[model samples]
Target chain A: MSAPAASLDAVRPPVRTIGRDGRRRLLAAGLVAPLAAFLLFAFAAPIIWILGYGVADNELASVWPRVSAELRDGGDELPPDEAVFAALAADLRGSQASRTAATAARRLNYALPGGRSLVTQTARALADRQEPDPGGGWRETLIALDPAWGERETWVALRQASGPVSAFFLLSAADLRLGADGLERAPPEQRIYLAVLWRTFAVAATVTAAAIVLGFPVAYFLANGPPALASVAMVLVLLPLWTSLLVRTGAWVVLLQDQGLVNGALMALGLTSEPVRLLFNRTGLTIAMVHISLPYLILPLYATMTTIRPELVKAARSLGASPAVAFWRVYLPQTLPGLAAGALLVFILSLGYYITPALVGGAGDQLVSYFIAFYTTETFNWGMAGALAILLVAATAILYVFYARLAGPRGLSLG
Target chain B: MTARRTMRAVSAALAGALLAAPALAQDSVTVVSWGGAYQDAQREVFFRPFEEETGIRVNEETWEGGIGAIRARLASGGDPGWDVVQVEAADILLGCEEGLFEPIDWDRLGGEDSVIPGAAQECGVGAILFNEGIAYDRDALPEGPTGWADFFDTERFPGKRALRMHPAVALMGALMADGVPKEEVTAVLATPEGEERAFAKLETIRDDLIFWRAGAQPPQLLASGEVVMTTVYNGRIDAANREEGRNFAFVWDGSVGSFDYWVILAGTPRIEQAYAFLEYIHRPEVQARLPDAIAYGVVHREAADDIDPERLPDVPSAPENLAVSVTQDLEFWLENAERLTERLQSWAGQ
Candidate 1:
């Protein structure tokens, strides 16, 4: 077998193992331990805490020891919780406590919107009831009454419930199920976030795909072209990065607005009857995003393509392959790592993007990062915001894993 | 052997406590505020004066980064970062709800009479005053767009308008456009139908508006003629009109008034110093200098007397401006902010 002769040198380890190996290994371990500890303490621990905070109230934490012990010793979970509910029922049933019940009933009545008196309804149920049914579980009772229950979902949910952490938030981001009972459903009055999440993904993916498709050919041309022209092409790519992000986004707004430069030019050339609604729509969003992120894709792809030998295509052609076949089979395969890197890079960057989308994108065009910001700054709902961030990170991690698997070991070099 | 180990652990804790003894004893007060001109003015008028009067050192911090930064410093489970924090009135309400801020001692704040009568007894003391108003390009309009009514009359105006897409202010503006009386805003918003009505009203000019979310964009958009008019911070408009030579005019009519206040965070170590700082900042002479620097109003009523009438009208202290502005119901905003913002975001995103 004609094994590649150069493989022998590549197989050799750069450094030999000796007395120094243990000291080197020890130093490396020492260096990494603090980093790992810092990451856990600073980043991971807080994230876990934030995720746990959604369902776990501080009062629950205070009672955790008793609660856990009771659960472990086979004490009833629902009965104690239902005891509170029964006490609430009893309090509501008491004629003397009618004012409080009426007040709560009035509040619930407002929510129901012109429905019959809530207190009267509760009274009827209480009058009809024999004993308050505290079932084997709170889940069972909540499910029975709500019918959003008894689905075997919460048990699987609890197991899948993740951590001191959860996927409830990520599920909430898409307006999906946290459990059988605890779905993050938008009210009938409010619009669903599931569509919003889908729209955001579609917009981001479109922007990334557009950038790749538009940027790839330009990058290829620049990569294979003469050095001076290549430098000029590189300048064209680098120019936008030097400008402020707001400035670039603003420029797009000017170019795409109803009476903007592009429309004015088009009108002057008699292309259409009126200016187009280009500035504050998905078109404007994709245009601005692609303009800004195009360089990100091109630079990586150009770097990868430039390093490929021109002779590979020539060699393939010389070996009896057609020019198109030679180029596609020989040259294109070499650039897979770059394409993967650029696509993933652009996709992830586009997902968390804020300024460009905010500047040029309309209300419907904004991505999920806008909501993350909205929650953090406006609502100050740190838990929800943290949960959204965790979801984005999880989604990105899953994507990276997916990409890594698709690309194989050598393609992992893109990272 | 285990008992000895436990004893050692207890001794180490005691040593750690002893190490922190001097810090516990020291009469140091920290005040946290939004940094920039505001911080500088507070340092000059409030902290420096208070420190000078009492000989207690004032440590100042900025609210530029993370809220957790403040929380973590406070959660050392002892003395917190700030004796006083300059928080938005809505944030002060939330902080009070969560037990994050101390209740103001009304007697300590000069029995609610020394400050503006209606303002002093709230969860916070009004420190800086501002209003949300329409800023229009004078050159573009030709006929001046004077009020929120004119702002929504896109037919006459016939130009793209921008508004800060913040739910609270935007919804309020929509209600004003829908002709809800100023005093009834909170009461009206309390009802689900009223909220739906406001959202529906905003949907009218939804296409015409280029929703600006950042503080900087409205002014930039106005200047660039991308938006001929915008609802923006009065100071941003005032600064652009005066300094940038932008042909702009701000109409205070139907503008919602807002104020930033100083409040003591709960469990602060330096309550006395915080009180001292508050008293210092509200002094008329000390408060008068702020309008010249930042163009926002100081809450000191007497401070307006020193400011020129021409200047005061454009400043938040102006009597004309005050007449046109409505006081924002912070408590109402506080209770409804979360659910309202969520709904608003859902609607806006659609």
Candidate 2:
């Protein structure tokens, strides 16, 4: 019985070693698994969690759970019923004791201009007070501590912010607020973010168009010129890309300032009597952005242009077409993919530029990303940062969809 | 309110956490502060000497400065990785309430009288004092600007000027320039009409203004002749003058001044060493060394006795400089930051 079994076990070695193709596939997956895990945890997860904060309404409710509960079940009362007040009283007492009242107050303040002080002041006033009943309920006590608590607006803000989910930040991104009656325009004094969003788009488009115009000739020369010249030119184009973005922006500052090299040269050449206002305005911003983005446009355009056969344009010219018509009809269409890819690249990169503009451009010329940085670093308002980020991602996605539609089946590809 | 509650609530939980805490290999205390040149100066003045004098292994790290950073570190476990941290004034107030910091023993720091007014807090001791004032490149603007008024009067100064992008110092400076008394700047700013008044003053200079975000940018802006005058940290102007021989003159009139405090994170095992570190920094000798390294004022007023009398007027805490300066009303800004920021941005966009 043992002799046949022993022979079968020895033959099973080939099956254990497995197929060569399967082994290769396993090795490839093993090599890529670390990168895949890194992208999931470090990159994708944080992005999703941050984006979640854009619409999340957890701050106020999480800090004052009892108040959130009362609001969820409070029905259609103006200043909310006495039960809501009692719940708020209990919640504030607990939050105040835990020193989390300020945290809850901060979220409320995002909706109401002076809500932070109001909530903290009230909580502090009630710090040592016993819980009130029907004999003397919290409605009177709360209203006395701050008369704003008696107002319908305060209750409404609380109700909206009492959330499993809410639209406060998302709506704010559009320069709108969530009123009891749905959406409302933000106050005139506060309606700047929407304009900032538009400015971001405008700047990105300007940079993209400028880069294409400036880069196309350079790209054409690199593609059609001698191979040795193209290699040297390629190195020159990538030189700026190798430097820190901040350094490149700083170099622009030195070149473009009122007393800087460019202005000095212009004055010496008798181009102007005085230094033109080029350092901290849209003009300067466009020039610096174009300089930084030109290489990106040139690289891709050259890649696609090199692939186009010169014989196609020559054939069109031989068929009795004018040189301009031949170039436009035959040669230009072939480079469209790269041209589209370069524009998309420059536009998206320019959209997120904050440091360059913040350092070199005037306050009026700042993009939406500046405000995102402002909120994240300066104000510590993560919800607002998340809102601006979501606005940017959404706008970029929509633009990408539109660009893809226009490009059609040939599509945009970074060659 | 927050300090008392946070201390009680967190201390109770922290008591149990300390039992599970692991033993350290050395008697080292890590202190975190704002990085760059400021931190380098701190190392030379406070960190290096403290290690030699007390034999406590002083470990140092730098942060970009945020309350959120402190909150994350302390909330991970009561024993925050770093022991003593230098935090902004608002963070001291906010963190105290959240119980992220250990309550200071004023007796250990030679009592509350040892420090300047507003330097002593329930949970923190003031580590450094800074002032933001109008600094003009003397070469560019031959007639140096005297105050925030000249800064706003573009016709008089005759060129673009840079102001901090934030409304905190800008609003106070604007109110002072608009003729509100230095002491009453925050009081007037608390009212809606006063808010509009400050913005109106800023509006006068909006076209002629470029905003700066970083402390280092203002000096660079001046050096580049991008602006004639800028609202800049006094220390930055001093550093530029000393290092680069840049003739930038700082005007103390209508300056906005604030403090950065040293706080011990709650439940740190190095409580005694943390106290010793705080005490060491407060010593008049140690405090005197700071002003020479950087132009910032020493927290201890008595440190002036050791400081060169000639250098006294250059600091924010000097009576002459303090008289003209407005201590930044952190509480007022904390309440209205969002409103003022958006309003300023809206005005700028227009």
Candidate 3:
């Protein structure tokens, strides 16, 4: 009987052996190809272009490779004396004008009182048809324009201003710069952007923490309530999401402004004799952002929490654990996944917010997005914008990694 | 059935081509310009007549924010989307700097003398109307202040006054208020001391001031009584006064005059069409209609012949209206824009 069974199995040769593998391979390819293609074309390609724009040495694309090659070939030493003058002549009077030179001029003109004259003179000399000999032309040009031009400080200032994807923008975000001697130093008068960055992070974290603390209890109540009550709570949760974000932010502005509804009510109630300055302040910003971001935190948590079984908690209670004990031991453990997810979601969203802050907050309350927008739109500085974007993307990825490590898989309990 | 469907499709194609042949024969053109009265006047007089005479279709695309969108498209290494862009001189200056637009071929368009002297130039051709000046609610201050200084005098005026947020307008207004003569506006703006002085005066009124970022905002603020006085576009204030019957009126004294021009983007596929659009829009009849309709001054001084001179004062097209206005220093503004704007925002923060 065993032999017959073995023979029968062998005859059958395991169902769908050859065709199944082929179909499975085809199915996998079908599932993944579109996503990969979309990422490659839409996201990766443009980002690569932006990165390339940031790194490119000059307007003429070919100059980038030649400059990079020259930098690599020179190693640690400065170019030879002959090569230096040749380079200076080529850089100044070459057929293709340096975009960096233009950017440098623009930036310097902003900083120094007499910088515009130096820039225009340099530009005119470079653009002029009368060519000076390579021997002392650069020296003469440097001396005629600025005595300080020979010093590395001048070049460093020019580089900081021009910033063709140099680490300067990333450094500027931190209020730091490469000094005359090539060491990283704090910005002028020893001012550091660390405080601003810290202030920003603190605000974002506070907003996120507030949203989560407020959202979790509400989401828990909604998730554990009776079906009819849960449905009503769900509607209430979704109500803000349906309203326009701008409209909601505007409503907050109306409520928070010194002479607005909330202040008027407070004053009328004799809560304060003078109208408290509510609009264009930190308190108003926090209140508005929390209201705006509350739904984002709550909705995700609610979705995650509702999936947890009530039977597990009931079983714990039946086994002689108190209600609070059962909740702490069973229900709370299951909601960890939701808590972790909500915190991260709210934190990331809050960091990139632009409109809410601009409308409701004062000048000092502006986030990093405001600076990014200023660079991109007002100054038309794509290189700095691209670098800033890259830094932001790096920060977000690092945060995600940090979050993932903190919330280990075991921390996520499900029914 | 499929064969029959194919046959139907072929016949449809044939029908379309047959119908389109006359339009093609006439050298059809399409222009993309700002929507509303400006576009309507262009359609009624220039485009319609041009089509009648030249047999060009003269289609139009109407939208606001045309220049910025076109520049972005050009920067993306794509073909410029607009055949013709009706933009102001300042926008043209920006476009020229970015290399996003081509210089107009004045030899081909050929209205060098017909265009207001100093209007026809390399980047664009002055198409329709100029705008300048300050407007105020007459009811709020019945005495009617004339120059920028009186405009800034809150003690005399005793109400909220609005100004444009742009440094070009703000700096000029500030200096003029601070006793720099109208002729010396540009010279003052060029110096570091002048900018500082202007900022100093502005700092005093910063609390009472509301800076408007858009063309329409100042007029709106004036009409709503949110501001009792403001520096406004001449036509916009006029239109608001007419529509809302507001007590506001404009003072051309110490106003920086600017003309909006019609330009073609550098890499536009339809150059001939764009030229046709420009040529059509500048016709005197078309130019005349726009001032009454849109409230902008027409570039063609001859266009005012159609409208009564009494009405022309109300319209921007009047030469008397144009005479009192000061032209802005475009090159200086272009050179220092980034620094000035950043400084303005930073100073405002303080």
Best by DockQ, which number?
2
Best candidate (score: lDDT): 2
Candidate 3 per-residue lDDT over residues B164-203, each given as its tens digit: 6567778888888899887888898888789889888887
Candidate 2 per-residue lDDT, tens place, A110-228, comes to 99878988888888888888766446778987987789999888888998889977888888889998665657899888899889989899999999999998899899989998989
Segments of candidate 2 deviating more than 4 angstroms: A1-36, A133-135, A180-182, B1-28, B76-78
Cα RMSD for candidates in order: 12.2, 8.5, 9.4
Return whichever of 1 and 2 wins on DockQ. Answer: 2
Residue B349 lDDT (model 3): 51
Q: After TM-score superposition, what is the CA distance of residue A252 in candidate 2 from its true location, in Å? A: 0.6
Q: After superposition, how far is residue B350 of candidate 2 from its true place, in Å?
A: 1.6
C-alpha lDDT of residue A286 in model 3: 88
Q: Positional deviation of A249 in candidate 2, in angstroms?
A: 0.7
Native-contact recovery for every candidate? 0.33, 0.88, 0.05
lDDT of each: 0.67, 0.84, 0.66
| Candidate 2 clash pair list | B2-B97
Sum up the clashes in candidate 1.
2
Each candidate's interface RMSD, rounded to one decimal?
7.2, 1.3, 5.7
